[model samples]
Target chain A: MRSGAAVLVEALRQEKVDLLFAYPGGSVIPIFDALYDAPDIKLILPRHEQGGGHMADGYARACGRVGVVIATSGPGATNLVTALATANFDSVPLVAITGQVKTKLIGNDAFQEADITGITRPVTKHNFLVRNVDELGHCLTAAFHIARTGRPGPVLVDIPVDVSMAKTDVPLPTEVHLAGYRPHVEGNLRQIRIAAEAINQAQRPVIYAGGGIIISGASDLLRQLAEKSNCPVTTTLMGLGCFPGRSPLSLGMLGMHGTFYANYAIMESDLVVALGARFDDRITGDVTKFAPGARIIHVDIDPASISKNIKVDIPVVGDARLVLEKLVELVHFVERRDWLARIEGWKKKHPLTYSSGGLRPQYVIEQLDEAAPDDAIICTEVGQNQMWTAQYYKFKIPRTFVSSGGLGTMGYGLPAAIGAQLACPGRRVIDVAGDGSIQMNIQELATAVQNKLPVVVCILNNGHLGMVRQWQQLFYKSRYSGTILEGNPDFVKLAEAYGALGRRVTEAKDVRGALDEALASGRTYVLDFVVEPEENVFPMVPAGEAIDRMIGGMT
Target chain B: MTESKQVISAVVENRPGVLAHISGLFASRGYNIDSLAVGETENPLYSRITVVARGDEAILEQIRKQLAKVIDVIRVTELSGQNFVERDLMLIKVNAPAAKRGEILELAEVFEGKIVDIGVKHIMIEISGPEQKIEAFVELVRPYGIHELVRTGRVAMLRGVSGRPARAAESGEEKKSKN
Candidate 1:
């Protein structure tokens, strides 16, 4: 006979989870007791549940495996809400296990009792509340299956105290069977053929890639199709590394903060091959005017995402890698020399640039790129710093650029860097963070120091929520209401207090040296670069304007 | 184009929070559900849900795709424009004065409805029919002042020997519209 907690551990073993990020609390002692004896699964305890969740999210994004996290009931589960929502928005596959009150005390406001399944329902792709020991085996298996399959997202399995303590003899299921859950993996051949025909016939075409390319491991197929068709590619924020930044066919990222040439190419193209990317509002500013002349062929695994935002001429639904492989087979080669020249002209005329100032964010990012290894993983918190990393750093590898894309959660970088560092033991992991956003979960510094992860936290200390301040500067007549960080703590001192190396750089010339020092440090390091607060992300398509209607940049 | 009321039905696994997940998807998107019904299907492990929603064709199409994305949902079908049988059950109570009682009884009988209960000041009638017929009956009895009303949303079955999978008929609309 095996206990319910033992069944859960066996299920985790079957799923091949080598590590777990967790925070122990009242209701999860039984599960923790089971984990204590299982030396195969190393449990990394974070300072808080939120940190644990983001760590798991980062681990999943870096390794392409379903990351696991364990938290207790009540407040412990509630703390995971932001990270869960962030993972959901970014389509990261995660299995979050939360402790619950005993089945008898579930709804009676028992100690540490919270409706984790109900609380996490909206954020999670799917959730389960295990009420009995018999249901534990299938429930855990189903959670893992649902998490890692078809447009992946976080899933939660809540185990009650009594259920975990109950004993059962039923072995773990070999295969999960959910009567309602079946995901379509193969691309429909007919739709794929039609898409290929459209690609073959088009002269001025642009390939728009999104995060799904990375999730489905379709970067190689994407590069192959782009090279075959001679089509320039523009990726969304989540799809940075799908195409090499230095490739001639690459136009960098496309969105509000996209490069001028990339945005113009999308608007001017006759055919847009949108692969694995949702035409989000941020990407398609002024939806009515977005790609006005293009016949969009949108390929996504989720049918709902196909035409939800923009109307498409051809809709191919399947896994990104599988669909791209099919397209590579059916698509004919074409050389659009004229289109390439036009894009090159636009790129040369309106290049991404920043006026010289004291420690520009862009310059800092460029130096960080230079100081770090080619295979280093760069995680970022949301804001101006994140955009700068996306703009300046040249990512040539998949799963190297991890950030909160859909939810844009602040304070995601540090913990995520910890996860990435743990996942890749010898590689240098860095967190490009905004001063305003880093403080949101800065307490995770303790977790890093305690675990001896050599992650470098590069803080762009602008003393303001730089993105919002920029928006206020441009559209709100510089009113700057509640955007300024008036009494920010000294980040270097904060880092030192956490028992880590800390340094500050205010001059542009010193940026590289600071980064080098931090990278060379064998322990966790925090480098605060005080940047020009007013520097805005350029080639920006203002809200309610077409992507081509960019307002700022060199003429 | 004017909005049309569409009937959507889905087969889902009988699991906890599945209903909430389905309903929450609509609510979060600001799509109002005009009426809804849920009950166990022929299979003990599966349940069927029907939602009557009014929106333009584009919104309705989005709703179908989004509902189908739910993991617990086995299938989602829009039973509109196809040969199908649909029924709605409504229990409506109306104030009936001495002179208005006869007219109300006559109106209910014309719609093939029955007076299930009668109180001193009101009458309760149960009606079962298509949405249009129910609407017509409700309109005729409006003069009597409806005191209370409840409806079971549309439940539908396709015509005999013409069963088509949800995904098959769905592609027809996409091909017809070229979108």
Candidate 2:
């Protein structure tokens, strides 16, 4: 008879979990002991539980697999809240295992005991509390299955100390029999035909892609559909790399910090084909006025996201790639040269531009794009740096741009970059971060260096929280408040302290060279680009305004 | 925002935190839950949850689909437009003075409610029926001075063999007729 820990390990092995990001504690010693004997599963330790959780999220996003994280109960389990919410919001598949106090000690206010399953219920897609050793194997199996299936999300399984240590002869079930949960995968043929007819009849058509395209591995189908229909494409911040950024028909990203042409195309289009995108408030500014003239055709795997924001004329719920494969088959080529010319005119009239001299954040992102390897993964911390990277980085391939899009969590960059590097070994991974956001999880530098993962972190140090400062400047009468970072650490010295290569580039001309040198160092590097302090991300549709009312900069 | 009350009933797995998962879904989304009731179904392995929420058509639709999306939720059905029976159980303790005791008892009889307990200064009445009937009963006894009140929110079931069609046994004829 095997111990419960062995059965758990065997289940994870059956699920093909090769790597686990973990932080050990008193309650989880049994599982750690099992890991000691297991040769195939590798465990990478992080300094903080939060960092490890974000790393798992990054790994899942980069590899399109179920990322796993293990932590002790109470404080350790609570630390994973942010990452769990982040993965749930973005639909990334992650399985989080937290060790609770013994079953008998639970609810008695025992040390290191917390209701982890209850606390994480809302944040996680599904959560389980292991009360019995017999349920341990199945709980884990179900957790992994639920996390990676359908509209993927984070699942948490809280194992009490006794449950982990208890011996059991129960074997792992070959199949999970969740009677209530069966994900609908196939696209309804009637809806597909309706969408095809809409695409064929529309004169000015635009395809709006979201992160779901990348999640479903539908970039190829998206490109084919865009090319076949001769339609311009506008992607949400999460959908950045689903279509080639440099393509003539590509409008880059559309939303609060979207391109002028992209926002305009969405406004003017007669037919809007929304693919795998939830109509979130950020993207659909002033929902009543969003795409007012367009007959929207929304395709998503989750039925709830279809009419949650802007109502659609046609709703198709299915996997992105599957729906697109059938859609492309039914679609016929159509020409709209006049519509293309109008988009070209808009692009020429209001191109993304930044005045020279002080090292603009946009310019730094462009330089990083130039110096990075072809397969480099770009992760970003929130705020101006994230928007700049989304706006300026020319992502030609899918799964290369990873960021905390839906949750907009700060300090996600460094840990995510580490996870991405581990997911795609030998690949160059960079975390583009803002000055304020980088410090949120800067301690992960040690985690990166210790793990020998040569990931780069590019901090756009502007001595201020750029996005909030911009909002204060535009709407708050320039009252900066607590947005400014008056005293900041010397990032170069900080990187050195962490035993990672450090470089600072102040001049615009040296930005590219600094990035190149850092990448060539073959060590975990931190390149601090001291950018223009007061620069603002433009083509922004002010909150509560319609997308067509975008102002400033290119607009 | 044109808000209207929509009653939604869902059958979920009788597992720990399943109620929290459902209630949390509404709370996190900034959706208000006007009333909620949960109890075990005929099958001990499942529980039926009924939620009354006020929102526009879009918000109501979102709630239904989102509730259905939960892993443990087996089926979700909106009971607003359907021929469904809804009920709420309430126990009210009122100060029925010696002179007003007969009057309060008469009102309870009119409402088809029963006097469950008679204290020295107060009497407890038990009532279970549609919300409107309960509300009317409470209003009639309000003058007797209510000392305490407890309600079980709202629970609903479709008339006859009518509910959200089970995924496993979805027949063509079931789709043709509401029943």
Best-fitting candidate, scored by DockQ: 2
Tell how far residue B76 is off in model 2, in angstroms.
Answer: 1.0
Residue pairs whose backbone atoms clash in candidate 2: none
DockQ metric for all predictions: 0.33, 0.37
Across residues A1-555, which tens digit of lDDT does each residue of candidate 2 receive? 788788889988999899989999988889999999987998989888999999999999999989999999899999999999999999999999999998989999999888888888878888889899998888888988889878899999899888888999988986787766777767889999999999999989999999989999999999999998888999998898899988999998998989888888988889999998998888888998888789999988888888878888999888899999999999988888899999999999988877777888888988888888767899999999999899899998888998999999998888998889899997889999998999999999999999888898899999998899999999999999999898899999999999999988889989888888888888999988988899998878999899989888853
lDDT of 1 by residue, B1-179 (tens): 47998888887878778888888888888997788889987666678898888898778989988888777787777888878899999999999988889889888898899899999889999999999999998888888799999988888877775466544543232111110
Candidate 1 is graded, for docking, as acceptable
Q: In model 1 chain B, where is the ten-residue run with the lowest total lDDT?
A: B170-179
**Looking at candidate 1, what is the lDDT of residue A328?**
97
Worst 10 residues of 2 chain A by lDDT: A177-186
Candidate 1: C-alpha RMSD to true structure equals 3.3
- How far off is model 2, as Cα RMSD? 2.9
Whole-model alpha-carbon lDDT for candidate 2: 0.88
